[model samples]
Target: MAKEFTDEDDALLAELGVEVETKKEAARTPREERIIAGFEEIQRFVTEHGRPPQHGEDRDIFERLYSVRLDRLRAQPDCLALLQPFDHQGILADAILVPGPDEDISDEELLSQLGVDDIAQNDITELRHVRSTADKRAAEEIANRERCEDFDSFKPLFNAVQKDIDSGVRITRPIRKEAGFLKTDIRSGEFFILGGQVAYVAEVSDFFKAPNGESDARLRVIYSNGTESNLLLRSLQRALYKDETSRRVSEPSAGPLFTGENEDNDLASGTIYVLRSKSDNPIVTAHRDLIHKIGVTGGDVAKRIANAKLDPTFLLADVEVIATYKLFNICRTKLEKIIHRVFDPARLDIQIEDRFGNPVIPREWFLVPLFVINEAVEKIKDSTIIGYMYDPATSRLMRTKDWA
Candidate 1:
């Protein structure tokens, strides 16, 4: 060991033009070291790929892992700052990592987040006791796909969905952590992204409780690549949760009023207009009384709908203004949400392509009779609409039950 330098020795060294060495930073903790190592591996991947790793079922395993690791690093500024010195690729600026984690990411978790599993037993930095065998098998079940013999029947559906997304009828939203109760959203005919592939829930069996007592069901999931898996609903939910870049593909719905984005900014300055579509479509003609377009606008109702036949919202035909309720001091957007929520179950499920051949899901059209609409308006006036929901079976507004 070197002798301790006294103040006299320090002064003598300075006088002799000698420099004393000092530490620039505190010694890194094991966690910080691991974080840095993980990030360096990701940097290596970036160097080899010439692009940052991306999320997709079709991407290479290591690339996917690097992508996930990059995501985690970006989310933690602390991790990013810590990794800055090692960031020779300038990835730190673009979530390439300028961080050190404020977390307890164990070796197993780190490996899992990087989408690594098969090599866990070999002990990556002695990742012992990190993953259990049963859990490993369960995770493997998600990726084990079989040839889909009936994929031919689903091919047209997939093609249609792709078209809808391309035309703005459907949208894909990031599967956020805060998306409450994901399993509830997984129903028959729903689509999701898992392992970077488009997944469709072709069927959902009766719900049963797992060992943990969470609700689960057997799902016949079909993939776009002609493979299928009979995975449990809980498995899909867990996969979605673990995959940071996973997304939920929304169903085709009447897209924009083609104009709600603009009107959403307007305040309490519009009339609640109810109009009837005069389209010759068999269904519209048959149930014309039950289907009405409800909307709010700050401009004249007649002037607003000057060219109804050209607009998809009016069902590509002229409309008759059946009723109009003048409003004062009411936030039109909030009222529209309330109305939609009240009659959500009664919403008319119709998809019409516009002149541009883009799929459009019309908004604000409900299957309620005229008298019910009048009563709903009166409730809005008295602020009693909050306590009611439109009941199509009973043909009236029923008092909403407070489950909470």
Candidate 2:
């Protein structure tokens, strides 16, 4: 039986501001739903970690993947607008927009952008099947490698890298394939700047085709801080590709430092002379090892020091040439500057009377051990003498915190 509606019932429904027609909730499109879900996952990550995820091999794999995904989402304006309501952490507010069209991206590149090599099948039935030999092989290849026991032998190499970094011979540039530091370019004795550290490709195994038909090799990577890793070449490539902060070290400057023949007529092949002052002063006699003047001379070292006793630069005292390392095709002035900068921390802070009876402070004298100076020069020869500071107490070269 149908019940009759009265004017009083209609008036009560109108008073409640209810519409007479039944309304259906709108459905979200698949793309919108995916964007929402992805953003929600990132928000959850930020909530749990108390910070946004960072990209690096050291970080959790899932965290690294999420970080890349978040970066992609931030680039899409539509995704940002959709996720604005859910972004309680304000992660989207400071997002950097990577300008590009979606059509320009390939499937492989898209996967790489997401910090992954491949996606698992969506079908549960396919996943339950017996694993193939190829799958097993791929799993074995991705496993962590054995530790490098001979890392001590590479310590000097690392020290040299730090020295190069400090000297501006090697500089950090944005990680890009055009920079010539790709997985295919990986070879033994190559150096790169990755993860804010100097990474050396000490050794590389022969390449073998993976299950996916991609070439892979095992790498012996040594870092500037005396740490070493035996990571897969592909893994290193992926890390470098995904990390925006990952930098490629510029090729060592091939200047007069390496050449035997002089390129410029003005530049001369010289020697870095380390002289011990033969001063009669009690202060100089008290510290023989601690007092030495480091300088570069283009002419004969003996002739240059023949009248050193009358010169204020030599502290008005005769000096004996303690050490001399032949420099091949270098500017004497520039080499002098480099040596002084390397030993700046241990510079001898002494005042002397010049020929004019005025107190003069010499700049080239440093209170450093002779062996350390030799080591520094060797590092310079190999082009790795930049970011190191001589620690007299440790009697070793240490990497500086900030090389820039």
Candidate 3:
């Protein structure tokens, strides 16, 4: 407590030619002051950087720490409300990204990544023993997945999807943020590529209100690896959004693939495959760019080529998968006819022996440059491929009417 200065004390100070200074108000508690100081540091960083600090391995240590600190500040309600008056940067509501995988990061590095520079008893903002966001999410995904005992029943569906992908009956499209979807977009009996495994949305529960007042639902998703997850619909969506290579396996469509719409029943999927031969033949080695196997499949490309070593159709040797254009609503056999006819003029003249030494004729392998094949695929998607034919001399697609 401060002693009150009386009028006599003020008069005595005036007699000695000393002036009294007015004391400013110090209303905030020490804890609040510390919190505000820490937050001011973040605001300074934001002012300098024009954005909040981000969490990542390649980022500067201070920036990562600030990011973690900001996350903690926002997560704690008292801190957020108390500092709301001083939130000049408006960072409390920003959709900040969490840290990426830190398995390769050391304990010391992890601590820094999680933004706990001090473990002292007095540091209220220090985060100790808390998992990084990515680790927590990964653990959630793993925890949600369990042994799918009824996997036997779903095995045929996965096999059929692989077969469809191989045969060009169904195609996989990468899930991009711009192309991200909502809970309603996830349909029962549909498939997706999550973490490199095929996931089938076996069941979807009725929608219910989440604690945050948003709508959510439970999902029974089965994976190709014979595992299943009982995760919330939003959780699945978040996982898909985070995985850069995540894909949605489309319903097989025998119609035009890029019309930008499909009926729920249009279950036709297809792939436009571009393959290069591993044959030791002189012609193939000499004009590698001009030689490829363009075919359609509804299943796994690697599995399709697994028996290539003994098959004359693959030039009796193992082959490499160069490119594949996954598309929707195209009939596999119909697509097979379309591409084969497009490049029929450049069909390679090759023969080889099967494992049994039987003289064989190869099919699908063509004497066409790979670019021409890509162009052909684009044309097919737009439904204009029928009017174009491969021109061997010009190495370009020419209209049948324009052919001289």
Model 2 scores a C-alpha lDDT of 0.69
TM-score of each: 0.38, 0.41, 0.36
The ten-residue window of minimal lDDT in model 1 covers 253-262
Give the winner by lDDT: 1 or 3. 1
Q: What are the runs in model 2 whose C-alpha is more than 4 Å off?
A: 1-251, 254-267, 402-404
Q: Which digits, one per residue and each the tens of the lDDT, describe model 3 over residues 319-401?
A: 88889877565567877887888888888887777778788878888888777787776656544465467889898787665
Q: Pick the candidate with the highest TM-score.
A: 2
Ranking by lDDT: 1, 3, 2
lDDT (10s digit) by residue, model 1, range 1-404: 97989999999999999999975988889888888888888878778657787776544455556676677778787786788788889886855433456564554565676556655455664443334555554455565566799899999988998888788676676676563435665678888877677889999999888899787889899999998888888788877877777777765542221222234453446788899998888878889988998888877899989999999988888999999876654567877887788888789988888999999989779998988888777556433455468888888777664212
> How high is the lDDT of residue 330 in model 3?
59
C-alpha lDDT of all candidate models, in order: 0.74, 0.69, 0.73
Superior by lDDT: candidate 2 or candidate 3: 3
Which should have the higher TM-score, number 1 or number 2? 2
- Poorest 10 consecutive residues of model 3 by lDDT? 98-107
> Highest lDDT: which candidate?
1
The order of the candidates by TM-score, greatest first, is: 2, 1, 3
